[model samples]
Target: MAQVLFLGGLGRSGTTLVERLLGEIPGVCALGEVVHLWQRDLRDDERCGCGERFSACEFWRQVGKTAFDGWDNVDVERVQALRDAVERTRHIPRLASAAKPAVDVLEYASYYARIYQAAAEVSGAKLVVDSSKHSALAHVLRAAGDIDLRVVHVVRDARGVAYSWTKRVARPESDGTDEMTRYSPGRSALLWNAHNAAFGLLARRGVPVRRIRYEEFLADPRAGLIRLADFAGITLQPTDLDFLRPGHADLGVGHSAAGNPMRFTVGRLPLRRDDAWVRSLPAAQRRLVGAVCGPMLRAYGYPLNPQETR
Candidate 1:
């Protein structure tokens, strides 16, 4: 069985950064957001972590050949539509107990499982880290029962997430183009609550899950990684967290399908908190986010008021 670590949470919660850090460890391959493989990477021809277009990259070419008969036989549009129909947030609860999943779910899971198997084979890693950040997909994979799936639910303060989503950050693609992603505070709060709740449902349904707060992980990454390794049934060596230099780690190439442009980042991962929102976010917007996410925020130990918390 392929040992898979599925990152489940809302986007911009440091999933990409954690994935990269975990990838630096020996015997682990971080495949960033394989959920976007059919749509963004293959159909849109996005750049891979290794700075090459998906079709042109030798590593992913092998993955395609190994996972599917060949890349040419895969219908990107059809698969993407199927994913939208079957794997969605609203459908997560039902899929969690879907002993006999819909044909679409089964088909997608088969294709996805092949990718995980191929990744483990090609990278020769004992574990494959998939930072897909989708609770629905996580539940589907768990129901499929084709691979050993473990989840690391990365959560961030909803206020911080709302602030992060409001900012316009550019994607670091090779083409010098930018992928601008922004969300209103209200939408961010709703998603933060809903995504976390969905993942919680999976845990209730007996999925092996480890919940990690982004702030706590940043406070002590070594400890956080130790807990994660323990949950995934892997042993961590001290050398894995030993930064070669300030902000630098000896990371290997991974053909992650899609994620923040940070996937293209190699070496020197600076660990610091992005607290700009506390200083720059407007008071009304902050309060609005607090109102929407306050109950869960407090449950996760985030004070409704940023001043009282961090």
Candidate 2:
């Protein structure tokens, strides 16, 4: 059976960083966010983590040939449409249900399995780390039962997440042309709560999940990685943690299809908390985010009171 470590959570919650660090381990391959493979990488010809356009990347070319016979049988448009239809917040319950899924769901699951299988084979790794950060996808994979799936549900403070999304950071592959994603505080808060709740629902439904708060992980990444590795049924050596040097991690190449542009970063990844939101974000927006995500934030051990911005 193929072992998969599925990283499911909201964007900008350090999923990419965790994936990168873990991928540094032997016998593990971090296949960025394969969720965006069809639409973003293949369709838009985005740069892979290896700095090659998806089509030009030798690794993905092999993955394509391995998964779907040279990418000819892979209908990017059809799969993209299928993904959008089946992988939505409202469809979480259905995706996780014991009832038989629709044919489209099965087809998509099969495609995803093939991708994971090929990734494992091509990388010669025992475990494939998929940092898709989509809970619905995790539910779909768990329901399919084709691969051994484990979940790492990463969470970050709502204020930090809200602040990250508000910035207009440019994509590294954009060549100064593309605009990064930015969401309103209200929208971010609503989605963050809903997304975290959906993952919790999956856990209640018996998905093998381990939750990790980004702040907690940042507090002590070595311990955080050990806990994550334990949950994923992997072992980590102290030397693996040695990837950290003064301010950042010494990273290597990764071929993640879609994620924060940090996927493209190689070597010296700074390890630091981004608490500027607490002091820099507008008080009204911070309060708005707190109000919107208050209950869920509290459930996840985040302070909702304005006075406790820490």
Model 2 clashing-pair count: 3
Q: Estimate the TM-score for candidate 2.
A: 0.96
CA-lDDT, candidates in order: 0.84, 0.85
Runs in model 2 deviating more than 4 A are 306-309
Tens digit of lDDT per residue, candidate 2, span 1-310?
6789999888878899889888888788999998888878777898999999999999889988998998878888888888888988788978877577788888888888998899899989889999999888877787566788888899999889999999998888778788788999899988899888888988887778899999888778877878887888878766767876665788989898888888988878888877888888899998899888888888888877645656
| Whole-model alpha-carbon lDDT for candidate 2 | 0.85
The parts of candidate 1 lying over 4 Å away from their true place are: 97-99, 244-252
Q: Which pairs of residues clash in candidate 1, taking residues 3 or more apart in a chain or in different chains?
A: 247-268, 248-268
Candidate 1's residue-wise lDDT over 1-310, tens digit each? 7899999899989999889888877888889999988877777888899988888998888888888868888888788877888889988867976667788888878778888998888888899999999888987787566689899999998888889898878776536576557999999999999999998898988888889999888877777777888888888887776753443455566677899878887666677778888988899999999999989998888887698756
Instruction: Give the number of the best model, judged by TM-score.
Output: 2
